[model samples]
Target: MNNINKNQLFWASCLALLVTSLSFGIRAGILGKLGTDFQLTTAELGTITATAFWGFPLAVVIGGFIVDVIGMKKLLVMAFLFHLLGIVLTIFAQGYWTLFISTLLIGIANGTVEAACNPLVATIYSDNKTTKLNHFHLWFPGGIFLGTLIVILFNSLGLSWQIQVAVMIIPTLVYGYLFSKLEFPVTERVASGVSTSTMYKSVTSPLFIFMFICMFGTAITELFTGQWIDVLLKNVTDNAILILTLTTGVMVIGRGLAKPVVHRFSPQGVLLISAILSALGLYLLSTLTGNSIFFAAFIFGLGVCYFWPTMLGFVAENIPKSGALGLNLMGGAGMFAVSVYTIFMGGFYDKLILQKLPEGANEVDYLNATPGSEMADALNLAKNAAGPEILQATLIVPIILTIGFLGLVIYMRSKKTNLIISK
Candidate 1:
C-alpha cells in the first residue's frame, strides 16, 4: 500500500476532531444555562443528553451502509446539515422534549462523523494503522481543550450561552467545506468485496467479542468521566469553569502525550493502566473533599484520556477489513452503552447523594470541609441520607477498569493462542 500523505490526513483529521470536540464542548459549556433555562435536575439533564444517543446507534449503522455506497463526502455533508439544524433547534429549544429532539438530531450527525472518519484514518495509513489512528484520535481531547478556551473567551466577553452554542456552526461550516472538496478512501470492506453476510460472520469471532467487551468498559469509563466531570465539580465547588478547565486540560495533555506512551506500551497496555488509574481517581475523588477532590479529578482525567481513541485504534489494527461497518458498530455500541451507564450514574448519584443531603447542608460548606474530624460529620450525614449509592457511583470507575483490564488480558492471550494454533 502507498504511504498516506501524512500532512493531508493530519489536517483532515484535525478538522474532524475540531467538529467533534466543539460539539461536546458546547454542550458542556452550556450545561448550566440549560439547567437554569429548563429547570432540569441532574436526572433530567442525563435524560436529555442520553436522548441524543438514541439516534447514534441507528445513524452509525445507516451511515456505515450509506458511506460504502455514496461516499464520505455526502455523509459528512449530511452530518454538517444535522449539526447546523441541531444548533438552530437548541437556540429555540424551550423545554426538555425540545432539547431532547434537537440533541437526537445532533447525535445522528456525530455518529456519522465517527463512522466515516475512523475508517478513513485507518485506510489512509494501512501500514501504520495504530500509530496514525492514535494521532488522529489525539485531536478529540485536543479539540476539547481548544473548545474550552473558546468557551471561556466567549463567556468572558459576556456572550449568551445560546450564542455560544450557535457559534459552533462556524467549525461545522468550515469542516463541511473542507470535506466537500476531499476525495474519501473507499470502505475497506467494499474494496475486499466482502458480503454483508460474511462481514456479520466475521464479527462472531472470539476477537470481535473480546474487542466489543473492552469497548463497553472503555466507553463507560470515558463517557462517564467526560460528560460528568463538570457536573461532578459543580456539585463539589462553585468554580465550574476552572474545574472543567483543569479536567479538560489534564485530558488534553494526556492525549497529546499518549502517542509516545502508547507506542511504548501498546494500546492494550495503555488501556490496562488507564482503567486502574481511572478507578483509583474516581474512588479518591468521590470520597475526598476540598482541593484534594479537584486533584483527584485531574488524576481521573489523566487515566481516562487514552481510552476511547485507543480502543478505536485497536480495532483498526486488528480488524481492518470491517471498515466503516465495524467502526459504526463499535461506536454505536459504545455510545449506547455510555448512554445507559450515564443514566445509571445519574440515578445512583441522586439516590445516594443529591436526594439524601441534609435539608440545609450548604454546598459550599461541603466543598470546603477538611478531610479530618470536621469532614466526618458532613460525610456521615451524606452517607446516612444517601445510603450506599455514593459507594455505587464510586465503584463505577474501578469496576469498569477491572473488567477492561481483565478483558484485555484475555483478548491478547487469545490472539496469541490463535496465532500459535494457526502455525
Candidate 2:
C-alpha cells in the first residue's frame, strides 16, 4: 500500500468507468435511429439494449473468482479486447443478431472494469471506502453528461450516430494505457487471510440476501428509467438530450458531495431516504409534464445518484469477509435486474400502444396512417400516452425498495446499539 500510486490507479479506474458511461449515453442517443434503420419493434429494441447487460453477470462473477489468481491486470486486458471488438462489431452490425452479440461483448467488458476496479479501489482506500467509492462513481454521471453533449452537438452538425459511438474508443484506449503498468494490491479478503469458505459464507448470510434483493429494485428504478428516457420523453419534450444532461449533471454533483451526506445520514439511512425520494420522483414523473418535468427529473436524479455506490459501500463495510465476490455479485445482480426490466418495460410500452390504438387498427395501420410523415404524429401521440403509464408502473419498484431499505435501516441501528452495549 505504501508503494502503490493510488492517484494513478484511481484515475485509471475512473477512465474505465467513463468508457462504460459514454457507451450508455451514446446507445441511448441512437435508440430511435437504430429502431428506424433496422425496422424493429419496441420489444426488439429493448432486447438489443438488454443484451448489453446479459454478459455482465457472467464476466463479473467469473472474474471475481479468478481475480486473486490471474490478477487484476489480466482482467483489464480482457476488458480492453472485448471493448475494442464490440465497438467494431457494433459499427458494422446490420441486424438483430449481430448487434446483440456485439453489445453482449461490450457488456462483458463493462463488467470486467467493475470486477477489476471496484475491489481495487476498495482495497486501496480501506479507511475511506464509502466516501472514495462515491467519488469514484462521480465519473459515471459526469461521463454521461459529456457524452450526451457530444451526441447532441453531432446531431446539430449533421454527423452520424457512428461518430458518437467512436468517442468511447478514445477513453477506452486511454484507460488501458493508464492501467498498463500499475501494480495492483491484493483484495481485502485475501490480505486479511480470510478463508475461502468464510468469504462464501458472508455472501450467503441473511443480511447479504436481504441487501441483494433490494439491489434489484434500486437498479430497476435507476437504470431501467435511464435507458428508456429518450424513447419515453420524445413526445413530451423536444430536449431529450437536455433532460439527460440535466439529470446526469445532478448525479455528478450529488456524488461529488456524497462524503458529507454519508457523514450526516449514514449509508443505510441515506439509502432509505433515497428510496423514498426515488418513489416520489417516479410518481411526479408519471403525473407531471411541461416545464415541471425538469423539476421532477432533478428530484429523480438526486434520488438515484446515491443508490449504486451506497449499496456497494454497504456491502464493502458490512460484509468485509465476502471480499471481491460479494461486490461482484451485487453488481451482477443489479445489472441482471436491469436486463429483465428493460425487456419487461419494452413489452409494457408495446401493450400500452396497442391499447391506445383505435379498434380494428394494428400498429402497422396506425404508423402508416400518413405516407410522407411516416407515422411521426401517430408515434408521438402513442409515446405521450404510454410514457406516463410506464412511469406509473415503474413506481412500484422504488416503493418496494423503500420498504426493504427501511427494514434494513432499523436492523442496522439495532445491531449497532447491541454492539455498543456489549462493549
What C-alpha lDDT values do all the predictions have? 0.71, 0.87
Output the worst ten-in-a-row residue range by lDDT, candidate 1.
383-392
Question: lDDT per residue, candidate 1, 1-423, as tens digits?
Answer: 243354665576568667767767667767766865676666788777776666777788788767788876677788888888987898889899999888888888888777777777766666776666666776776666666677778888998877877777887888888777666667667766878777776667676777776677777766656655556655455555555567667877776676688778877888788888878776765666667777877877787777777777777677665667777788788888878877776667555553456676554454345556565456546644352244345566557667767777777878889999999
Model 1, TM vs. native: 0.85
Across 1-423, the per-residue lDDT of candidate 2 in tens digits comes to: 777899999999999989988888888888888877777788999999998878887788888888877878889989988998898888888888998998999899999998988899899998888889999988988888888888899999999887788878888888888788888788877888999999899999999998888899988898888878888877658866677788889999999999999989999999999999999988877787788988888999999999999999999999888889999899899999899889988988988988876555577555445545646566667767898889899999999888888898899999999999999
* Clashing residue pairs, backbone N/CA/C < 3 A, model 2: none
True-vs-predicted CA distance for residue 320, candidate 2, Å: 0.4
Score every model by TM-score: 0.85, 0.97
